[model samples]
Target: MRKPQQLRNRELVLLIFAMALTLGAFVLVQFGAIGELDTKVLGVVGIMCVLAFALHIVLRIRASQADPFLVPVALMLTGIGTAMIYRLDLAYVAHWNVGTSNAGEHQMLYAALSIALCIGLVWSLANYRVLFKYTYIFGFLGIILLALPFIPFLNGGGNAVVWISIFGFNFQPGEIAKICLAIFFAGYLVRTRESLTSTGKRVLGFTFPRAREFGPLLVIWLISMAIIVLQRDLGTGILIFGMFVAMLYVATGKTGWVLIGVFLAGAGAVAATFVMPYVHGRFEQWLHALDDDLYNASANASFQLVNGLFGMAHGGMFGTGLGQGRPDITPVAGSDYIIPSLGEELGLVGVFAILALYLIFASRGAHVGVAGQDDFGKLLSVGLSFTIALQVFIMVGGVTRVIPLTGLTTPFLAAGGSSLLANWLIVAILLRVSDAVRRQPRAVIG
Candidate 1:
């Protein structure tokens, strides 16, 4: 086994590279956009650098055995994201003469808070097993969080009622719910995997769980459908349900469970297209984004989608270069359409590199799951990893028109405080699990 100090040293080395990449991107953006570096932005970058190293220190002391690359990769993505937002902020102000977006500054602050939360979680959660004891509580809390947006007074009104306001601060409860639900799913599946695996009957070479064993799947399916129907957000519904299904398959080692999940998800989505106008409009925009009338529609039309596509095309293979391209022309470029924004400036290669980072993060997460000695840790780690992977697929697929766009933010690469918090917590949990897996004594045959 590797020494903890050795693992930490490796992490420190990679962290330096990640920080360099971040700082380099910021420098390019500053020079390309404003012809001069801004001291305030540099100060923000300094703070982010300090926070990154602080997280490394915390890991060395509390989670030295954790995966070395996860934190660095996530930090790199966050840095690039902040740089892009800052670039767009400059464009918005320069071209339109609008009030400063301040998105870049806010994203930096969010990154700091997220790192602090990650540090706190790593420090306090000395053992990941304690989470298993409160599985149902997490599940119930997840449900409550999902429902909070529906309350009249507390609701943070938007086209999609998915945010809740508390003390004048608006946050998306669904982001936090994803974590709670992942824990619940992991714990519940660990307890029930035996029946879910053994009691199923074989039909045409596939084992189908009995009605009793299938109850949990049905309940989760209902909840996912409720999210789609109630919240008017397709992405979160797909995200949560897909996460549960992935975890279920991992638990049972049964492909039949996945087949069943796909069918249910397909049915729900199809029914939604007919019954929900918003859903139907999205499908129309996706299917016929170039249609003159549809493109010309003023409200909730394909304007954003078409413009994003044009911007990406304008970028071509190598890209128009950071801050040289007009990513701000697309609506909400920092949040929902950040990929396109990056695509416009960074080109296809850059997008692929970004995707590669996600792939590495997800693969490391899966590695942690496989190395885990306990069932709960394995399931939780894999579930969390799958959540991030599936989210990336959904977001990228939507932007490329492979799927209709929904309101899901790009994981660490988008400007959303709640998403940053939830994702960092996941990273903390993964780190904790990795540390625990390494600390376990290896079994040997003499």
Candidate 2:
């Protein structure tokens, strides 16, 4: 194996190229959003450069054996996202005359904070395995984070119960909660995998786990129900339940578990639509988006989705060339609908390129999991990576009308502080695991 210094050197090289790409995006946003580039944005670009290199410096010291590709990929995606937000901010400023509350600026701030938090996690969490030791504690914290959105005073008092407002800043605790849950799931499964895999019955050429093993599955399902019924967020409910099922399958190596999860997920979705008016409405809007009367019923009715579709359609192959496209026409265009905004501006090629980045990032994350010597590391790596992939698929598929839309934001791209922070933390955790895997001694055939 190459020395840790070599890995760090490789990461340094990638960081340089990544920062250049980010600068190019920033430059494009400036030119497209306005007729000329601004020095202020340039300053922000310079800050990001410093921050990116500073992060690399920390990695060199803290996680020298970490995967070289992950951080660079994250930086690139974050840059692309910041550029899009900047473009929208420019349009909003010009149209509404509101020079304050710039989403792009906030995104940059979040990026810096996220990188710092990542550095902190790596610095403090010397051994990823210690997380397994405190699995229950992390699980408890995860549950509290998930429940925070429902606190009467903390609640953002919006349609979403997944957000809490602190000192005028709206935060989605679910983002962090999901990360904590992945760790807890990985650890818990490691402890219980042997019992969970005991053969119970054979049916249709498939073997199922024992009746007692169903406890965890039932608990996850119930949590998903509460998230949908009480929290009023179907997307998060799906994401949480789906993530648990994925980890369970990985732990137990049971095809039966996945099949069961698929069935439960479908049934739960149908049940939620019947029981929850908000969920039902979303499904109806998705199903009948093209119907003119429904589309025009209310100003905010189906307009967002319809507008997003029109934007993408307008974009076609090559988008209207970044800032030239009218992405601001869609509501919440900087967050949940950011991908559509990008699809509109960058065209299909840009969209494909972005997806490819996600693909590579996730692939490397999975590789880290597969290569790890310990079960906890493997489970944690796979769970974290799968969570991201599933979220992206749901977000992109929803925008494209491939699935009913969810309220989840596009990761590293959308204008959400909570997502920014949580994703960066995840990167830190994955890098730590990667380092551990690399440091592990190779098996000897002799």
Maximum-TM-score candidate: 1
Give each prediction's root-mean-square deviation over alpha carbons.
1.8, 1.9
Q: How far is candidate 1 from the true structure (C-alpha RMSD, Å)?
A: 1.8
Model 2 Cα lDDT, one tens digit per residue, 62-174: 88888988989999999999889988988888876776657888999899889888888888889999899889999999999999977889999877688899999999999
Q: After superposition, which runs of candidate 1 have C-alpha atoms over 4 Å from their true positions?
A: 443-446
lDDT by residue for model 1 over 244-313, one digit each (tens)?
9999999999988998999999999899999999999989988999999888898768999999999999
Q: After TM-score superposition, what is the CA distance of residue 237 in candidate 2 from its true location, in Å?
A: 0.7
Report, for every candidate in turn, its global Cα lDDT versus the true structure: 0.91, 0.88
Per-model TM values vs. the true structure = 0.98, 0.97
